[model samples]
Target: MAHSSNDEFFAKLVELFDYRKGKDHGSIVLTQKRLTYDQPLPEATSDTILPDLHPPQPMPILIRATNAKGKEKRRAKEKVKLSTVVDADNLPAFFERYAEVCKVGMNTLKPRDRRRKGKAKKKKGGAAAVGGP
Candidate 1:
């Protein structure tokens, strides 16, 4: 198949699987014939999708601070190494300070919790009971 055709097919497949449970769209292994458009159109399978070999783990953040002064006669100071896990609640604050200190944006920070919207539903009778006795 032509490159464009392959791209279009991939897009459709992604759209189809985007909301499907237990589906991974990353890292596909296309058959040689499919790539070359040879006879007997190649088939696609979930074989390309591998389970998460390494589960998510929190990594630490490191910060270093230094102060120095003047010519031949000089003074230098260092601060303790600090570490933190990046999370939704704290990420914006972390980045704000990080940018100020490092002068570089660290895009590697992953959200500890996925973005969630809206309030959770209350139990059926819990609200009514709370106002009584």
Candidate 2:
């Protein structure tokens, strides 16, 4: 999961760690000497006070819009535009908008998929028979 901000990522990491440990009663230990700008695998294990491992630091978010032709497009031209950085307070709104845009895009891509099952069955003259008994 790509995070829009370091703070958000950190918060999620803490939450995940706490959940994994089954109890939030330990200090997070960063034994790994190097800290890179990337999101660590959620399953990474750490042998520290906090049994669960910390999520790796995430890099800055990059906002890039693409056109129907698969070419990069300007944010203004795209139907959905995400900000480069978002804090916890605004993250929910950002996600809500993002999900809405994704839903719209998916709907536009396959409108037929939204058809009712009964309507589809009726159009196809009921369920087709499978292999003979």
lDDT of 2 by residue, 6-73 (tens): 34434443443344355424232221122233534455345544422444443323332222222354
TM-score (C-alpha, index-matched) for candidate 2: 0.31
Instruction: Name the Cα RMSD for model 1.
Output: 24.3
**Predictions: Cα RMSD each:** 24.3, 16.8
Candidate 1 residue spans exceeding 4 A from truth: 1-55, 68-89, 100-133
Residue 16 C-alpha lDDT in model 1: 27
lDDT of 1 by residue, 71-112 (tens): 442333221112223333544675565444332222234544
Clashes of 2: 0
Alpha-carbon local distance difference test for all models: 0.32, 0.39
Superposed model 2: Cα runs more than 4 Å off = 1-63, 68-83, 112-133
